[model samples]
Target chain A: MAAAPAPPLPDFEPAGLLRVRQGFDLAAVDPRSTPGFDGGKDEGERLLAAEDEELSDLQERLFAQSRSGARDAVLLVLQAMDTAGKGGIVRHVIGSVEPQGVHHKAFKAPTAEERSHGFLWRIEKELPGPGMIGVFDRSHYEDVLVQRVRGLTPPAEIEQRYGLINEFEAKIAAGGTRILKVMLHISKQEQKERLQERLDRADKHWKYNPGDVNDRAYWDDYQHAYQIALERTSTDAAPWFVVPADRKWYARIAVQQLLIGVLADIDPQWPVADFDVEREKLRLAAS
Target chain B: MAAAPAPPLPDFEPAGLLRVRQGFDLAAVDPRSTPGFDGGKDEGERLLAAEDEELSDLQERLFAQSRSGARDAVLLVLQAMDTAGKGGIVRHVIGSVEPQGVHHKAFKAPTAEERSHGFLWRIEKELPGPGMIGVFDRSHYEDVLVQRVRGLTPPAEIEQRYGLINEFEAKIAAGGTRILKVMLHISKQEQKERLQERLDRADKHWKYNPGDVNDRAYWDDYQHAYQIALERTSTDAAPWFVVPADRKWYARIAVQQLLIGVLADIDPQWPVADFDVEREKLRLAAS
Candidate 1:
């Protein structure tokens, strides 16, 4: 019997294809579109498996460089609605690397103490240290996204947050942080099916939030909020990628490719030994 | 030709075989021995690969239970000599689960502020919240281990820490935390070979600490310190497991199995729905 041929790799890069540019229209993007990737589910998974090792190696080099006082770091900010696969990206993509080198935070609604300070106060505390890959499940953008959609903040106050976010990101970028902001874009229909699955499965009940269903009533409002947030805050220092996330596998692979691109660009090298190697070897032998 | 037959699984559980008992002799245990496991390198690696999925699932369930107000959590505390594979246990074993659910802390020398407070004060702040798996690369045990060996603290003060640790762990255990302490035991000859390999490889240079060779001068003192600490602190609430670490693959697999046993005993079930499932289904259909 003859062997089967190998599958072709995705030719285009997700970084260029998925990045939100000036006048980018969220309504125009089909949630089901795979963008740069042409593969089906099985092939997408296979490609991810192939890329995982390189991702692991690159992250280790970044971590190693940090120990020698290198300030370079990568911050991956993931913003999504319910059932949009933010948890999946964390588990499958960031989870591929050494957990010690990855700093992950999943932000929730503010507490009384957090609300007393500026919107970015809590976020500034959790930024990744040198050579670490920082992940934010949802971030400071909620000031404009949910707060704006629900009219929880004044119109003027919500409007000012965009420029403030840009300034904050520029400061972080100046400190040698490479920021990749991603918004997992899933359609209303897709979310309905996903939410329904949660309701149906006995094992998935804890994940089913009744508030998520109530949020569905304001679907168009949230989408408008997202479009405006994407337009005003996406800058050269921190660009947002609107990933079509209806196909769970496609979303994961695209985010992984984006992260791999960021690390490769940093091109971190292992730190050279500062001490004398021969002396250390002789010293060890004596011990 | 037919496919190769599957290898047989190891018969004994690592949890029982590796736990440190009363009057435990550190000198009698062989660093090269693979107790409760008859497998060689290839089989050990294969077994870890096979067990990885179950470990991940068990972790997810534990995380899920926490969402429903469950107080249960697991803490894995790792103590080891230099080049004894503490990093390997982290990357290969705990890294297999969701990074979000794993709260990992690698303690360095205490800062000036940390030094001013009691030693346990800093450790208390970093304990994992409900439904999380906390990993300490080097933990409270270091206060006794390194501090005792170097006489950094008064011998009278060092004597008090062991009782403090036991009381602290028992209080934590009463609050539904399962503590698994592991000491990665390696031979001094094996340490020399590992340290030499690090010095030879340019890529491994960053991991080579010159201070490690200095520490080896105090090897016998350190081992004696470990013996006393292990004997005093290994209680039923948080028993210490002394894992043979000369074989890296065996060490990784044994830790994984021990973690699996802990999670399985907890037997976290998927939480039942608090809201009406039928009404939610209908509401989703309307949306």
Candidate 2:
């Protein structure tokens, strides 16, 4: 069969078409036009369901292929605005692999010990072996995203660190790792509704941190920071796919597709054994 | 709905049943003799399905509840014989939670760095925090399983190590963390079939090792060791369940049940936020 055409991508506001497959139009996925899809609302759910099934099958193949030992390990770094479902995407995507073959590292606040060493010190040790996949829920990118938005580092230093991240990733690639970075971009109003949902339910109350709302107030700064990070860092080695986060399910499906693509390239196969010696012994016994 | 009684386990070899569920009767399960399932299999499968759905739901609920600052983390430890699907069970069971809320650490052969510390040193740091579910691919039990089967450690010292592990895990539980251990068991013929399948496929060539075969030679020794491990380690604080490995789907379902039972006991409800400031602001806006 001939190769199929790529999906069309959504229109970019400024630096859009992040994943830019042929037919997928992320640009047209405006929240106001179809806010909170329901059975009655029926906002193209049928279209997505058909496409998601195809992607899931492709993902299973990638999952199967990535087990080969010769291939480079796949590393996915997920960064999202608050309430953008970063954790949700991480769970759904990497959850299928053999856990031995899939390693997950969540980068939290820089530890006193971690701060004493180079930023990559703690991260490098956690890289997945050739037969495995490693995922960082919040990764080394935080050094750029959070540090930049909070002005933890000076402008000169921030500009310098971007180059540092690029070089660090280059070293990772040179050592046989494929990296896919995703940034979940949720809109302001969607954030409001999600936060409200948490507050409305007693079981979800703990998720609504007041500071998160304060952080949401600085949504514009965070977006600009994302823009710079994406512009400066998106490269052939590790391209950034800024997934639309308002529709959480779509974002998850998109991330899974990207991961399936990366893992398919890794070639996950089981190793064969040298059975000649045992075979000879068994033959001798039979005779 | 009324809670169902514990599900009836499948007919197992006396040894397998004894090692697994503690009290399975071979006579009761012999398909050649027994005319009917007695609703045991159906009930077990139903409970398994229920448990899977419940655990999947709980994973999301826990992820959101994590911000409540309650360290109600569930630590799942999979200990079993080779080809038992310890890794496979994990891949399918926790497949839904986002990677951020779930941390997977697979303890491999001790690196020079890991061996330098006390045996459990590398494992201790990787334990899950409150709100995060840490899935250990092969955990501290390796000190007991691999090292024993291979005669890597002296028999004299193995006894002390067992006590030490119990004490170590006990302390972890006492500190408010919950632990559930699943031991995956499969028949010898089934294991050989799985191995052969791996060898026949070029893609799976990376998984079969001469060493795994070497270890397979001592399948009886390993089985005895596992029986001991299950008998000794299945405590109230951290119980070990021997799961059937001939069917991977069943094992995943069983594991999800164990997790829901353990995590639910922690009563993983979200902590209500003291949202006085936001409520006052919203009221002012309304006024």
Candidate 3:
């Protein structure tokens, strides 16, 4: 009573269920920047690169298992404010995957064609086939994230879309798809720093867009939209993971863990060898 | 008398060179199958799965351009016995390319890791990155095709030690990489029938391995090793593209064309905005 009850604690657990989160920070593995190369430095670099490579390799194998394990597929959705390292994750984290097995679908501003179809139609076209992985860059969630920030959708409509997403995602899950959404969370200040860095690299200038600054102006509104998105879409069938973005290495490793966890659970095995077929054939030639 | 030495036919450009090459068979494109969807209807199918969605998308864009440009990169390195489709050029024509930048890289036995470092230690290093396209299903070419054919690289060298490949590839090909290598020119009989099918899939499979029916007897030997490999080493960086044994149509299109051959000279605008000061400002704000 004397401390005025601390404003009732702000109700941080909007969904009311506390998840036991295992920390995953992909950036922790960075080789920190040792310049000189000759002996030890070279070895250190190789070792770190090798460690990253092995972990990456494991991530890839697990992803395939998850993709092909069940009748349904796994859908990874990435959502983030500008300047977050989404592209970087794709470059290093999943860089080694074969082009044929990984499906990447980017959801740009809705086109008249996309609008003619239901919100999920374009997405449906891009869904991973059985035994494949699909990634939605700036996916269906944009209906909530962008529309809300731009005042293009009413609050009531925003709520409606969220419910629709939940229903659609539930159907996907029930039908066999594993849906996991990831929102890369970078602090507004961190984003500002990233944007500036982009300006610094002349070669990277093409990646810069003036529109990003305008989006920054409404930071608070975007935050509220994100908060609501997290609250509404975080279900067991398709939970949203808010990845900490200050450290990119952590983000990638976390994504890998999620993949490993999902695939390890899915455990897709090579189809049963024909009863008569020899499983392991050996040859002694390529010397 | 009738032939005053015929000018030596200008050296015939070495094995399998003069014969027109089938760019890539296209009938394999199941327009309905999205980019990542695998058409493989077999238990032995394999591929590398990726985590980075953005990178995957960029690969598609790059592939599309690679296939379109004059200097498109469609490096075909075929390694097989007598009947493989290497010489099935006219029948396996890759029509999508604009008739320019396609190349090839062929591998021969090691001079040494060819003895020392490992089997793949050499080829593990030659992949094409980002814009330029490079294809190889049996590259780092030894581990199987050559290793199993000639009793060359000791057993232990080919066995358990074979799995140490993932790390080797992670470091090759600077960042953005897209690779697809196909094994064409198949079976000994198919080889003879095909020779009638037009001088026999070019008989170039001999250039790399030369052994013949002697090599064919070790078919099971080669297959088992290949199967194990197709199962284990197909990473995100490199995945095997198994063209159908019967039709080059399905096989060529599945490959050669996936490179996207669209852009010849990509002039990406590099941003020149002042960045250091802005970065400092953002850094201060981030605090």
Per-model DockQ against the true two-chain complex = 0.73, 0.36, 0.07
TM-score of chain A of 2: 0.76
The model with the greatest DockQ is 1
In candidate 1, stretches whose alpha carbon ends up further than 4 angstroms from where it belongs are A1-5
Of 1 and 2, the candidate ahead on lDDT is 1
TM-scores of all predicted structures: 0.98, 0.77, 0.49
Tens digits of per-residue lDDT for model 2 on A1-287? 44555444332122244553334333354533322223221223333444445444444444444443354667888888778887676555555444555677778889899999977788888887664567787888888777888888788878887899899888888887888888777777787777777666767666666677667656777777877787788777777776777876666556665665565555444433345545533432332
lDDT of 1 by residue, A1-287 (tens): 44466757666488898999997999999999999887789888988888999899999999999989999999999998899999999989888899889999989999999999999999999999999999999999889999999999999999889989999999999999999999999999999999999999998998999999999999999999999999998999999999999999999999999999999999999998999988888887888
Query: TM-score (0 to 1) for chain A, all models?
Result: 0.97, 0.76, 0.75
Quote the positional error of residue B143 for candidate 2 in Å.
3.2
Order of candidate numbers by TM-score, starting with the best: 1, 2, 3
Model 2 lDDT per residue over B195-285, tens place: 6666556555545554555666787788777766766677777777666657666566556666776766776765566787468346323
| Of 2 and 3, the candidate ranking higher by TM-score | 2
Residue-by-residue lDDT tens digits, candidate 3, B1-287: 24333221111111122111334233332322323333432211211111123223433344444333323222344545445554333112321221111222345556754567656656646555334444343356456556755776577766654466655544452243434444443544454443333212222111222234346566656755655555555555544454444444333433433332212123212224433546544543443
Scored by lDDT, model 1 comes in at 0.93
